[model samples]
Target: MSGIQYLVCLWILLITQSRFVRSDIQFIEKHEGDSVVFPCAIEQRNPAPFGVYLKRSWLVPNEILFMHTGEDFKMKYDHDKSRTIVSGDPINHTLNVTISELTTKDTDRYYCEFIVENPSSEDEHIPGKTEFFLLVTADTPASVDSGRIETCSGGSVVLPCLPAEEGLAVEGVSLKRQKGQEPVEVLYDSRRHHGNEPPSYSQFPAERFRLTSALGPGGITYNLTLQQLQPEDSALYSCQLLQRDRPDSHASLGRRALFVSVKGDDCSCSSSSTLLYALSSAVVVLLLTIVFVGICLCKLRPSVKPNRQAPIYEDMAGFKDLKSSTKLAPNHLEDTVSVYNNTSVKKSCPENHYESPTGALCPRNETQT
Candidate 1:
């Protein structure tokens, strides 16, 4: 009876020791638009996967982000379905989740819970939980030494303000401009909007200013991006962090003096790619024109030297010349003779001689008798 009681007590002690282990809280920081992996493991060697869940503190009521059964893994959130991936071999008893394209809102404490089928009882399972903290921050972190941002006019610049502490929750942020002696509130956001809508801005033009916050290794850092920058936009700027339920508790997170210089859109301001494209296009056109002209010259060269033939003359019977017996009359005498002959035939009938058909002399009628 004493040995039986001792064996039962030893079995109970072993079960309690196995269930009391807690995972260490891991601190991780990732840049926006990046990816991160959460690691989880069960103390039981080669534990059978019954069910697994991942939850967050900010997501109240239904905080489950992902779940896994012995068959497959599934996600409860709409956005998580696309970006979440469960990667780990079940044989290794590791439950690892990888999430891609991390945003500022992804910064939170994540808890991973695993359920295994109970060995002692049928239709029952035991659960264990572990936690990890993730901080999603921007690629460009704010510097504490100097707060100065430089940009050209008509462009945009992000004024950075990173908190010095780590894992601190951000309640609200306000951006201010200090010019001369007075400070003007450029934008103020309380982070209390619905449907994932961004925070609201104050008196300043809402379109020109945007509020951005990210989780960093230090803490929650807020930033502001000024759009359509102008020379007048250059001034001393500062961003303050507000405590929850304490509107007056405006803590100075960072200060940045913006220097926006006028950017002229002149010929020299053209991008290198545009200039290179223009030059390449011009060169291609010039080469094409030269090739076309060369082809035309090659095609026309054969026609330049024309084929020639010698002239031919043919004689006619009437144009044959015959030798004349009488002396040839001069051009002036021939003209006078032609005029005299033409007068002899006019109006008066000559009694001496009638003109022959060839315009030569002929005998009169009395001589013929």
Candidate 2:
């Protein structure tokens, strides 16, 4: 029995030493028409993140105005069922956000938290905290600017939600639905508005909306997965914060406007690609012009000769002949080194020699013949 108890205790110690930890995230700041990356990571090996939560609220002007999670949509007046959704890839562990037509009331501090189940704990799980900040502002539409655009119908956009404070640790992010609709019936979802282009414009896009707390790095996130994009999904979207007891007033978190610009069939297709196309064309034209000029010069060049002597090729035999001719010069020809004697002493041609005043032998047979 004692040995059995010791084994159990040893087993417990081993388990304690190998405890598994949950995931975390890195926060980022992004405005409308811009881009942001919400990080979510796991400390344990292959710990499955089945669910995530994210929440946003008004900060300065009015606190806790409105909010949303992946589920539940509520406003002061009624339930808004078609405006929010979560659009991140759990497998890739990235939380991408986008805010369509922003309004002034969407400015506020955002929060996010992730939960993990601890099998060994009494509660069967532990709620892990996620830290992040959100600053929802009104900016230009990214679909039209240098921004990378994505199309979605219904509720399928990862809106970048900004929290009032940065890095505030929280247990779990809640998705509270809010009600805020346009009484005038905004123009965005309409089949007729689609025009003759491949992309159609439709009015009355989403049927409802909701919000939730994300695992890490929080901000405005998605709630609905749009089946398809329609002309109705073209208008601006507002991410309002939910209050503590009574959600913030629609007037509290000012609205942000995002002008829905489409890739119409006539947004200037003549220019096709970017300015790089023109630059490449210009380079090709310049090279061709240079080649043509070179060809013309080569064909029109005039013939001419260089004012210099050509090279001479000789060997020892040629050198010997030159030397003999120079030495055997005729008597009348002063081709050799001039002998400057003061007295003309006519000496006899003794054999093949001529005696001079200096008593030097001369090649008389070879010269003066």
Candidate 3:
């Protein structure tokens, strides 16, 4: 056959054998191994299509996981093939996905599209289109609502996870540490024993760590305490909802990655220091408040008050006694002073010492003192 005939035949073969459809995870929920349905509507939600193919590309990670284009491609990505199972007859166009084992390295923006016909060399060949973001969180010091991660070589590290919302009856909790390709389970709890639940406990993954339930102010808080942490413990930690059905971690809600710089043999945290700092801050604030109050008092002046020592010299009130030789008394007057001078004044020179009219001494006899 001529090259042209051969090329045309190959195109026809791929397009015919390989069907295409669309798929994508709904919701913006970001996590690893989250099952998101990639819709492959046959005719924009009408009748499902007859041909379907699943192809996904991760831009940030720069990896392409396309459907096996050929037998060689299938062999290279066989695991992916088994992991990916489709539902709904292609003739009807519906697909569901279940990615079991998820990793932190799965952080990437994904696009899943289908081809109506391969090598169509035409516009109608493109099938369905959808995309999703998978933020594969690390499994290190895991918590539902991860707060902060701090680590020292042989010291202590605390990983706090905050749940999406409060009031979730977390039945059990588990913490897993992933180093290289190996995941070491550090903490496990069989029963949270919240409300009226009974307590359950066990041992696994040696004795590096243990999970315990404690009644905290934060409400039945679950904790995984590790003593004498090892250097190899440094890894991406994750907290998973403890479940027995699949006996596998559900989805990780929180994560943190940290490097430990071990120094000597001291691996314990200094809660005392934190407390001391807090106490000192409180004391300083209290002192400042007291000082502020004192300053305000000092700056505020008092209004002037009437003096009790001042004599009450008021004018005589109305309806005074005007006849008697006695002076009139005021009804409300506290005190009265009307003094009468005994010494009398004489004219400059009483004329020739006029006969005394019960009064004057002549100036001739009077001396100006």
Top candidate on TM-score is 1
Candidate 2 lDDT over 45-116, as tens digits, reads: 345443444445333322221222343323333332233334654333334333333343443334443344
Best-to-worst ranking by TM-score: 1, 3, 2
Q: What is the alpha-carbon lDDT for the whole of candidate 1?
A: 0.55
Error of 2 at 69 (Å): 58
Worst lDDT window (10 residues) for model 1?
Answer: 320-329
Q: How many residue pairs clash in each candidate?
A: 2, 92, 24
lDDT of 3: 0.44
| TM-score on alpha carbons, each prediction | 0.34, 0.23, 0.27
lDDT of 1 by residue, 61-92 (tens): 24555455645566776767789888764434
- Candidate 3 lands at a TM-score of 0.27
Summing lDDT over every window of 10 consecutive residues in candidate 3, give the lowest-scoring window.
316-325
* lDDT agreement with native, every candidate: 0.55, 0.37, 0.44
Error of 1 at 227 (Å): 40
The better-scoring model by TM-score among 1 and 3 is 1
Superposition error at 55 for model 3 (Å): 3.3
Off by over 4 Å in 1: 1-20, 45-47, 58-61, 65-70, 89-92, 119-130, 139-369
